[model samples]
Target: MGKILRAIKKIIPEPIFDFFSPVYHWILSLLAAVIYWFPSRRGRMKVIGVTGTSGKTTTVEFLYRIFTDAGFKTASLSGLWFRISDKSEPNLLKMTMPGRFRVHRFLYEAKKAGAEYVFIEVTSEGIKQYRHKFIKFYAAILTNLSEEHLEAHGGFENYRRAKGETRI
Candidate 1:
């Protein structure tokens, strides 16, 4: 199944893929959620979403420390890396926000690790791609807003709206 999916992904032209990416991503996000058993609510963990033009990663790291210090089993996902309980590793993908499947997998792993809470660094690009879909956040922290990734997000307002979607 994985091989076939990979092959199909490679066969799709970049231009065509980009044009249809929104719907494609939305469907894949939904599919991943179903396969992962709806990670947003399945783990019984409180998910905290942190978003902003800058400092999201740092904030996630800080929250991770705070949660761990408070004696709660915690997990965190950011562009830098991800931590599940006491284990940690680097995110070599170079993507601040990976696809929904990867996020679901991480959440599922965190749940299996008995995490009481998961802190996530949300990005405007990620939200636009629906990468934050299916994650039920208990709280959302907006560090600050600014004009960044304007071209990718189509404008400052669009970028802002995408980031705002994480709160919902």
Candidate 2:
């Protein structure tokens, strides 16, 4: 799919690509959810989403530690790293919230690993792109919101709305 997207990007003009970008992301997100069998739903895992203009990674990290220390199998995807229980690796993707398929795949893997809880660092851009879709969040935390990503989100209000959109 990655290769296919790259090929399409090369073939399509920038304007055309930009016009269809949202639809593309939406389809990919829904597809990923279906392919992963909606791992976070049906009470399969306690998915906690941490979103805000700042401190998302820190919150996710703290939650990961808290859950693991309490003897609950835990997984986390943050800007700094990705962890599954006792093992963790740096997040080389340079993305706080990864693409749709990657997000769903991680949730699926966490469920397979018997993780009781999963902590995810959500971002406003990710929510705008529908990357937060299909995950049944048990809890949603907004560390803090400020005037950031105004340009990308069009305005502060839009950015704030995007932050709130991550609740599901």
Candidate 3:
């Protein structure tokens, strides 16, 4: 019986090894779209995007604090938290990047909550996958560049291109 099960597993393609992968991602993308679209249709929002090898979280937090202090309703998605228009809490994402659609969704939710401003921490990998495509930024802060995630990006030049592409 064990041998039969093993044989069945071996016969299955590696890509088909996880049956839930496609369904899971589809659900997530749909959720993200719903969250972003509803609030955006209501009014205009000022979006601030921060991308770098380090200090993304700190920079986002600083901007959040400043915006809130100025009395604007603000929402921020950083390494530490997923904030929705003055209602911030710890990020519960099981995966670091979550999904390609998550950032857009979070922005959508913030907009729904009447957030005047939104801040996001854009990662190099996310940029590579074209996750930052949909959202328009009012301002972008590029803190600094460094070497990281060389394996996925192939080399330093590819990594730099991944980061630099975000600016265009």
**lDDT: worst 10-residue window of model 1:** 1-10
Lowest summed lDDT across 10 adjacent residues in model 2 is found at 36-45
Model 3 clash tally, residue pairs: 1
lDDT of 3 by residue, 1-168 (tens): 449756866888767845744464456555665656644335688777788788888999999999889999999888789887557778787533445566776766687688998888878877765566556677788888888888988998988887776652
lDDT by residue (91-154, candidate 1, tens digit) is: 9988888778899999989988999999998888889878888888999999999888899988
Per-candidate TM equals 0.87, 0.88, 0.73
RMSD, each candidate, Å? 3.5, 2.5, 6.1
The full ranking of all candidates by TM-score, starting with the best, is: 2, 1, 3
**What stretches of model 3 exceed 4 Å from their correct place?**
1-42, 94-97
- Deviation in Å, model 1, residue 66 alpha carbon: 0.9
TM-score of 3: 0.73
Distance from true position, residue 103, model 1, in Å?
A: 0.4
Error of 1 at 152 (Å): 0.6
- Give the winner by lDDT: 1 or 2: 2
